[model samples]
Target: MKLYPIESGNFKLDGGAMFGVVPKPLWQRTNPADANNMIDIAARCLLIEDGDRLILIDTGMGNKQSEKFFGYYYLWGDHSIDKSLAAHGFHRDDITDVFMTHLHFDHCGGSVQWNKNRTGYEPAFKNAHFWSNADHWKWATEPNRRERASFLKENILPMEESGQLKFTGLPENHILENSALGFDIFFADGHTDKQMIPMIHYKGKTICFMADLLPTVGHLPMPFVMGYDTRPLLTLDEKELFLNKAADQELFLFLEHDAHNEIITVKHTEKGVRLKDTFTTQEIFN
Candidate 1:
């Protein structure tokens, strides 16, 4: 199996909301924000080439939204879905599976694209089976007030409409076996309902996609949970359990939102879960 980081690009998000109760001074050091207090975040997706399947995880925010719609996030950088796919000798249609961690726009927007006529939408991956649990799919389709803005119908509805949407077993199962990503998916509910964090065992090393569970190294502490999480206390429990497990197994955490750090490992220091060491993506794969 081979894994490639498909960096779609970087975008800005409110640092305060991202860092939760953590003070700006602390988070700003790792994820420096702009004048408007919006920190740059990488819409970093992962591509897995396992056996005969080429799977893409969490398509970045696609370029379909209107200028006014994208104005809010301030998307930047030259990296794009097409460019990144080409870098790995793949294309949009090459994807056999679109493994969404969740259905938020930034996470799944790139799964569909604006059609040539610019009149409507179509599946970005023409031949891919998009995967998300049944419960999360339902929750995103009928989004609540807080998440309604994030779960755009245009970015989601097209999957089912295309007849390629499939569920990943039961909602209660945190550990999903035989994932399309070719890893064991550990589910977390705090971030959003049934968000799957892919725990991959490559060679003798374990690499985990820390989705929004731990957005940046700044979020290493349990309490630095995102304000966007539905249940912050549940996040605390999830983080406590997950991090400890990662530490015990020596898993390298691949940060999905951190603008700089690609991967890190943590330890149970006197100050709680502190970063033990850091490494680049190449260091692990090389």
Candidate 2:
């Protein structure tokens, strides 16, 4: 199996929102803020070429939103999914499965795009079976007031409407129980309801996709949780459990939202679970 890092693009978000209640002095040291106080974020996706299936985990924010809509996020970058795919001799059509960690716009917005006629939306990956669990599908479709803004209908409804959506049964624990997908899923609820974190076994190494549960190296601390999460207290407990296990097992963490650091590993320290080493995906995968 071969794994590729597909960088979609970068955008800016309020550092305060990203770091939650963590003080600016503390977070700014790692994720420095701009004059506007927004921190850089990447919509980095992962592509796995395993036999006949070319699985893509998370599609970054697409270019269908209006300028006014995008201005809020301050999107910036020259890289795109198409360019990144071409770098690896692949295209959207080559993807057989599009595994979404969650339905947030930054994570799954590129799953659909405007049709040629501009009359209706269509699945971006024409040949891919879009994956989302029943619980997350419902949570995103019928979003609560706090998360409603992040779950846009334009970015989501088209996948189900196109008849390409598939639902995976939630795992009883962190085990791959009858899951059609090749990877084991770690179901987390603190970030959002049933956000599936993929635990992929590749080349004698276990790589865990750190979605929103652990956005960046800055978020390694247990108290550093996102404010966007509905339940911050629950996030603390979940991070503690996941980080401890990651440190003990010596797993490589594939970060989805970290713009600068691509992959990282953690170690149990006197303070807590802290970052051990950083590497480009190629360093480990190659």
Candidate 3:
């Protein structure tokens, strides 16, 4: 199997919101904020080419949103799914499965796009089956007040409406082994209800897609949960358990939201699990 790190786009978000109650004095050291208190974030999606299937994990924030809507996030950079795919000599049509870690606009927004006529929305990848679990599908569709803003209908409903939406089986335990997408899925709930973190076995190593569960290296600390998380306490437990295991097993974490650090590994230190090292896709994959 071959893997590619797809650069969907880059944007800036309030560092305070990203690091939750963690004071700026601490998080700013790792994720330094700009003058406006905004920190750089990347919608780094992953593409896996295995045999007949080309599966894409997460399709960053698409370009369909209005300028006013996007202005809030401070979009930056020229990277787009099209350009990134072309870099790997592929296109949207080549994706057979679009497995989303969650339904947040920044995670799955690129799955749907405005149709040619501009009359309505359509599946962005005409040939791909959009993947989400039943629990998350309901959570996002019937979002609570706190998360309603992040789960936009324009970025979601079109996949189901187009008859291309598929659901992955929720595991009874935290880890679902041998999923339909050909990888183990680590189901996490602290960030959102039933957020699926893909544990991909590739190139003789396990690359865990660290979605919002661990947004950036700055979030490695136990209490450094995002304010957006509905259950911050639960996030602490999940992160502790996951990071401990990651350190013990020497797993490579494929960060989706870290603009600068692409892949990382953790080690057991006196202060608990901490960042051991970071690597670009070229260093790890090639």
Instruction: Pick the lDDT winner.
Output: 3
Off by over 4 Å in 3: none
Models sorted by lDDT, best on top: 3, 2, 1
- TM-score, model 2 to reference: 0.98
* Cα lDDT tens digits for candidate 2, 27-112: 99889999999999998899989999999999999888889988999988898999999999998999999999999999998998
For every model shown, what is its TM-score relative to the native structure?
0.97, 0.98, 0.99
Per model, state how many residue pairs clash: 0, 0, 0
- lDDT against the true structure, each candidate: 0.88, 0.92, 0.95
Candidate 1: 10-residue stretch with minimal lDDT = 171-180
User: Which pairs, if any, clash in model 2?
Assistant: none
Off by over 4 Å in 1: 171-173
* Model 1 whole-model lDDT (C-alpha atoms): 0.88
Q: What would the C-alpha RMSD of candidate 3 be, to one decimal place?
A: 0.6
Cα RMSD of all models vs. native, in order, equals 1.3, 1.0, 0.6
